[model samples]
Target: MIVALTITKFRSFTIPFAFIGMAVLRLPLWLNKRCRFWKLMGSGKDAQVDLPADYRHWAILTTWDNRETYDDFNFRSFVMKWFNFFGSESFTILLNPLSSHGLWSGKQPFKTQISDINHTEKIAVITRAAIRFNKLKEFRSNVKRAAEAMRNATGFILSAGIGENPFFDQATFSIWENMESMKAYAYQSFDHSDVIKLTRARKWYKEELFARFAIIDSWGSLNGVEINTNN
Candidate 1:
């Protein structure tokens, strides 16, 4: 199974240094032998809770052939070099796809056995899409309410609004207490259902991807609180 290694950082007062250093570190990441696909992302304020844009926070989303491949880069690549120099706190999550559909930049970036939808386990969900130019207003109008629904939803852990570009391009990464809990919120909630239905019905996105993963392992903090990702 391939895995998604996503990490978000929260920097200290020296914002300029961390920002520039992170951007410069991408060259090394793109060249990493073990990494199959990757993205440099901007993140929201907190992970467990859905929040607005937080400039001090940024993230790295990448896929690897296997755990060892990811581990090698974690310790040996320039990605680590930036981590050492930044002095900010971060959290890294490893995920195994349970289910996935659609594409990311015209390609699927993950592969794993189909998940047991009824299984009770910690889970992660990622929703990424490039909003269509003509449908931008429609998409933008729906974001706030959907975010509120996520934050207050039952069993919700954390959710982050991230993107390659702010506003125009967007994605969400959220963790849940269990599959049942996540499904309930995603499928049963009115606001969320409306978002999903219209996204398909109106073709709100030019490109999009939706995936569910089992939390294989993780460490560190998302917003000063360490999460337990061993499942």
Candidate 2:
């Protein structure tokens, strides 16, 4: 069970560089040298599509064995420094492997390595919802309906908590097998339609959406706790 950990941050040179050093370089090195990390790099730097300009300032995908290992690494590593430096906001997903998927285009950070891990074409659709402060309950209820419908469709992956964001409005994250599956659920489903209608009707959002497509390469616990990994 590889979990998806997606971190998005506003553009800042110092923070983004630190994230690469700490999470991609330092953390992996520490894990391989000090703990247990089954190192698997993707195909090449062109494995996936780059995030949209608006959202490309920072992002990363890493997998983990379980929550326990993730927790251990978080408390014991320099990873927190990256988060602190970037003022990061994150969303995580726990996925059950899907047999069919889509491939991300070139331009992604770790594109090459990603293509090697899971050659089968797999696409992931990530939808982020941010709601007003007092509308948490209503927003969640609506999102729950959409999630339920999406999960019922073929190629559905497990979805997790709509975690709170310290620096932004309420947030929710979900995973899907492919773009088609996501489209069917997002566009054709009745629940999703209602959510959209309500959102537009109420004008519940204070900001526009931010999203991206990424290929997960390899992930697992650095220490022993399960941490969400991207690929």
Candidate 3:
């Protein structure tokens, strides 16, 4: 499957349209024939679990049927027109889903795939969740610790926090040197493990989606740093 992440930082004068465009982009995202699942999100100020956010920046994550289909929309679509009209800086990332579990909006966007990650592959993992209203405080409280743990985890490369709405629709996208290293962080880290356990016991998420992918390619900047394709 095709998973794409587009991040755009609107010019100060164009911020209003960026706000409006995010709401307007939803229709075409769902209506598009090739798109399977999509989310329009805001970004945290740092590349980890963060509280303060930058209203000037936004993100869009969508799953498409194939690479060519995504390319067509990326290069030629109403959404692209909006980006051109209202965007200043934008980055688009294309990925291949190696495996996925759980759900987003009650549906599993990516079907289960075998654990075929190779030793040389740079693994990309994404976790998206819509937090339950009552659990917001707890979720936020644990974020700093979890972010710290992740940042310090072995083989960790990079990561960022994103969401559709503040404190509610939250997600994290992190890169690892390989699948094994990612698993070690997910399963062995006490801080992360505690957060995961609390998520289940507390029922923090109203809906959630977890996915793993093999990095294909990326362009432009995320949080002002260019994506490193070789890593």
Report clashes for each candidate as comma-separated counts. 2, 38, 0
Give the per-residue lDDT of model 3 (tens digit) for 1-231.
788987787778987897888788889887897888888888887434565777777778888878899889888989877876677777777778887888887888775444654536888888989988988888888878888889899989888788878678888988898888899999999989999999899999889889888887888876678877666
In order, candidate lDDTs are 0.77, 0.42, 0.81
Which residue runs does candidate 3 get wrong by more than 4 Å?
46-48, 112-114, 117-119
Global CA lDDT computed for model 1:
0.77
How well is each residue in 1-231 modelled by candidate 2, as lDDT tens digits?
Answer: 343453433334454463354346554535543333222111101111111123222333434554566556555655544543564343333333333122222111111212324333334443334456776556655665665676687755544322223222323344455556666777788987888899888776655342334444423321123434343
User: In candidate 1, residue 192 scores what lDDT?
Assistant: 89
Off by over 4 Å in 1: 47-52
* Model 2 C-alpha lDDT versus the unseen true structure: 0.42
Order by lDDT, highest first: 3, 1, 2
Q: How many clashes in candidate 1?
A: 2
Tens-digit per-residue lDDT, 161-197, candidate 1: 7787766678898989888888888899999899899
How high is each candidate's TM-score? 0.89, 0.44, 0.91
| lDDT winner, 2 or 3 | 3
Deviation (Å) of 124 in candidate 2: 2.5
